[model samples]
Target: MTGLVIVGHGTRSAAGVEQFAALVERVRRRGDLGDVEGGFIELSRPPLTDAVGALVARGHRALVALPLVLTGAGHGKGDIPAAMAREQQRHPGLSYRYGRPLGPHPLLHDALEQRIDAALTGASTAGADAGTGLSGADAGTKLSGADRAGTWVALIGRGSTDPDANAEVAKVARLLWEGRGYAGVEPGFISLAQPSVPAVLERLRRLGARRIVVAPYFLFAGVLPDRIVAQSAEFAAAHPDLDVRVAEVIGDCDALADLVRERYAEALGGDIRMNCDTCAYRVLMPGFADKVGRPQRPHDHPDDPVDHHHHHGHDHHHDHDHGSVAVVGGGPGPDDLITVRGRALLDAADVVVVDRLAPQGLLAGLRPDVLVVDAAKVPRGPSMAQETINAALVSHAKAGRRVVRLKGGDPYVFGRGHEEVQACTAAGVPVTVVPGVSSALAAPALAGVPVTHRGVAHDVTVVSGHLPPGHPDSLVDWAALARARGTVVLLMAVDTIAKIASVLIEHGRAPQTPVLAVQDAGLPEQRSVSARLDEIGASAAREGIRPPAVFVVGPVVALPTTGPTV
Candidate 1:
């Protein structure tokens, strides 16, 4: 009898395990396969050992290992294959094959349709319908075959670093966006990647899409998906002009069972005879002779052999358990201004990995031999890519060097340090971050402008100036920012000064409201400009002053300057 093994990336949540188990059982009840079993590679499990052991004990000779992953990366590409290889070795008599992940499945489209129907129906009950009177029939349209010709769908997934995984999501997105008859399809990620859900939604809305459905391509309902739902609500609320709906996550369905069965069949060799002597099954038969009825293979299996050179064509001698590197933020160009903890790390750094903004004065007192690298960069021009910087930090730290990934300001605040931290952690290189003063607050103070001074401003908001164009956080509630009864400071926005000012002015920030641009602040090249919010762009353009520039806007900025003593 053929055995089907469904594997999941085990989670700590018991509820998640129960869901997986229930899914497996439901598929089993359909009587599609001879035997159905579930296994986990990590966390909760009837681990692979037990799952395969049970199947082998049941006299199953052919087995299929179906990875319940949304994409083929990390676990799907490497770990699952490794586990299956181990299982194959242990049960040499069993012929097992692994299958592709259940991504871009049409059933996922069905789940999306159901979710949209539920949302719209709930909306109608709440009296939010616009009289399009889109019933279930209108709401639940699939982007398949001819119906997809002009159709476009935005398929959003939780982003992964594995290129293959992202490629799979992108492939599915292309099918929905370009293949279908709809207007277009877009692939985006909730985190760890770009074309964030909000950006994708906005783009689709602007595409003159009379009807736009925001399909979430997630396998489970977790924090990220919940966040996407909440964001969808906010997005729809913001754009009452657009018809938007958030779809449900991919759930248990008969299609998933079919996918598992397909995997099983593939493992058993779809075109080749299952009982042929040249089969992989010969390894299990051992002394049965007939040369195991297969080709005389080399003694070394390349997949299992250890190679000193890694797949990346780089020399890697680091152990798997290297401690994380230390990425400390030095704040915006100050030595003593750095947090005491950040300073300590700076002093102790074996390799003072500085960005363009790390004050040289701070590094002056450091050990001369300490390695210092310039990773600081800007966008749209010559600068280091985030991916490159992250790799360098992880690689150096893995080599047992104390790395200080010193950023210009607060590491967590738009510094891209989170990306670095994730890369390091994924590579088994530990990381610790120390906070520093962000220019958002400091620049205003240095210019005799208080973000909040009683009766001058009540609310203070600090926003990044150079958020990537397609960033999820780039969409500001400009009206909210404009209505700030207090001070507003924008950091690193030299390039966006014109646009930021325009948005504010349009949203009720008075054209006459005083705004100050502090350039190269806290250093010798420091310069300051005071202009009305409307004229700030003109002033910046005239001065030809670029970043690292901060914009301070508020009535407090109109306060009389106390000279350079400020």
Candidate 2:
């Protein structure tokens, strides 16, 4: 029976020595060879010369020495071979052969794949923590492949001095990315790489990646791998949004035995026989002797298997002319008070049809490429008619482009959003409406006034003061509203403020009822004036306030302010 000897270049770092020990333990567990042992070449106890001398004393001949270096250059190429030559000469009667280093092998790719699988699939136990839970199906629920797309694996290792050594590790990571269908694969070093593991994880978070797994691309358990794992754990803990897992270190499996055997075949002889019985002896290797052995997968391809013959074709469809129009309600005057979605639409708009009500400062967020068309621009005196504005909205949509109709407050409340939607629909174009924080309510609230209070008022009525024509009818029946002890809010009533206040006072309503006029509701220029129903008209005139203001009146207006304190 032939004996196998695995040799590693001993390092001063304790982590490096532990990695070598783990590899030797793995090789010893494989029950295929007669004797399996490992020795360190330098910088460590149990040096190669002494170990070979001991093996020769045991009468083991035809010993195959394998180098566990990650690269074929440097120590594996020169120093280890030179040491073997000196050992063979010291033991003149012992016959020996030296094998190649473990680099650029499909087996290394396999090891990486296994690490990824373990990190992604999670631990075997029901509630094991380290696992990322990447199984395609779990508990009778199948997960879509796209759902796992953002799952990333970053291979972190101790940087190599040799450029070729670094390239080899990077190449293995690339192969694993393609083979496993990962969303992204990145090669990082604890020292050398531009994007360290932490930097890469930060970038992944910005990219909206939900889960990341760090696979240490080191052979045996080592110091650097431990540090990298610890760093990965700390990074994961900092970000609760991302799930992170540290995978098992490479070269801790017997499949690596096949890698060592293949490299040996490339060195001294050729490939080994498939059957273990044909070999000289069946021996136990380290890490491979689980009493029951980790249960074999029922179906190795638990999910989709690679189909070499399966081909797909790209299908081209007709160019969609679904012209989109963005209707934004620029709430009162404040830009930040607008919904986030509304702002996004306005920023990307092709054409922004702003009215006289929208604040000019809020329009600064529009993209430079956007075409601003002021539909309500009173060029000489007054703006375009309502029918003309509606026609313009229909024309923009029919041209197959984005149109943003910026309005003030809730578009439906007084901005006429339904009218624009109907016009777009009639033109066979698409329309999306983004509701904003209506100034009708925000205005009163920001002015230290609550339209509804526990006992003061249980109901509120909102109406436009201007009638469509001269039929002399307001939306709210003033006679009926005067009888109810509720609040009343008015929009675009500045021109008729004196008349409305007189109407309420004449309808058997108290002239001393609290009234609040909130101007520029949410903007920096916001101002609020509190007075009685009769004094509101005089107070507003004194303040020189104009239209686009909200008027609120009722007993609820007397409630204590809920706004910020001085």
lDDT of 1: 0.66
Candidate 1 lDDT, tens digit per residue, 1-566? 66888887664445556768878997889886778888776545567667878888888877788888877645665567677776677778777766777666666555544444444334331112211221222543333444334334667887753344566788777655442355676888876456778888888777776455666786544556666767767877787766666655555656656666665666666532122232222332221111122222111112223332222111234221122366677777756677766766565566776778766688788776678887757556678778888878877776656677888878887778788888887775646766778878777777667778777778888877776333477776777888776788887777778888888887888899998898877776778888999999899989887878888888988877684333
Per-residue lDDT for 436-490 in model 2, tens only?
7677788888777877888788999886776522335645677676677899888
- Candidate 1 segments whose C-alpha is farther than 4 A from its true place: 12-16, 59-62, 86-95, 105-152, 178-181, 209-211, 270-566
Where model 2 places Cα greater than 4 Å from the true spot, the runs are 1-321, 377-380, 467-473, 562-566
Q: TM-score of each candidate?
A: 0.45, 0.43
The global C-alpha lDDT for each of the candidates, from Candidate 1 onward, is 0.66, 0.65
- Taking the candidates one at a time, how many backbone clashes does each contain? 20, 9
Lowest-sum lDDT 10-residue window in model 1: 125-134
